[model samples]
Target: MVSKILIFMLWFLVWLLLSWPPRISSFITGALVSAFVSFMTMDILVKDRPSGRSPLRYLWFVYYIIIFLWECLKANIDVAWRVLHPKLPIRPATIKIRTDLKSDIGLTFLANSITLTPGTTTIDVDKQNGYIYIHVLFLKEGCPDHDMRLPVVSKFERILKKVFE
Candidate 1:
């Protein structure tokens, strides 16, 4: 149905991007690969049951991508500055934070978003209790058990909740 076609198109677009300078053969190959992957994963992606989510979820997801990229850009600059500087201001720490996201997709998206951002990696997720253990390059002075203005998580989680929760 519509969901499958959308998924196929998305995968194909991603494949096309990755296989840049798209030749006819590459296009054909990408199409085939995208179709195959979509076929394989559509069941998990587009469940038969009515999801009851508004179309606005897709819009929110698009906005989420924009936010994600912006965050990544900022993180990249911060990490680069830290690396280039003599001090290499990095305070590596793994701290656990509770998430309000209840759905598996929402939690996974939040975790992956945290992992994708520079200087942060999702070490573990306690899905049952809604906790995420994240390893951050810069824990910002006060951490481990104290309240710190975590450079990541909140922004992405807020949007992800709208998209997936």
Candidate 2:
């Protein structure tokens, strides 16, 4: 099927990129692995194959990567500071936030992005309501009353809407 071929190409490209300077042996091995893996996982790995993404979506994806890296750096610094400070200024709490993205792929990317950050972990996703519960190592001083959506989450959700939704 077309999807299986696409998956094989994707997997082979990743193999070549990661195992750079692909020698004959590695190239042959990657082809075999890619073919086997793609065939085996085609049905379950991606339930919905989005059809014909706009060029703008690719641009948004690139922007999302930049934003994600910047947010990740900030989170790393904040976590490191908390660890080194004598007071360990941390008020860990779980808060619910809303996302606009509706597609399963979009939600998955958003949740994974949150979990990948240093200080936050996505606890649960309410798919029907577009709500995510996230555990944060440090909540804002008045977080219980204030908007619970962190800027990183908002940025990711926004860009992901353009990219995936």
Against the true structure, whose lDDT is highest? Answer: 2
TM-score of each: 0.74, 0.83
Give the alpha carbon lDDT tens digit for every residue of 1-165 in model 1. Answer: 988999999999999999898999999999999999999998889866347888899999999999899988987888889999998788888888877788777887888888879789999988887788889888765554444335457778778877875
Report how far off residue 3 is in candidate 1 (Å). Answer: 2.4
Candidate No. with top TM-score: 2
The residue pairs that clash in candidate 1, if any, are none
Which parts of model 2 have CA positions greater than 4 angstroms off? 1-3, 17-21, 50-52, 142-148
User: What digit string (tens of lDDT, one per residue) describes model 2 on residues 1-165?
Assistant: 666788899999999998999899989999999989998888787566578778799888989898888888888888899999999888888889877888888898999899878689999999888789999998776654455567768878888988886
What local distance difference test score does each model get?
Answer: 0.82, 0.85
The true-versus-predicted C-alpha distance at residue 102 of model 1, in Å, is: 2.7
TM-score of 1: 0.74
True-structure lDDT of candidate 1: 0.82
Model 1: lDDT of residue 86 = 100
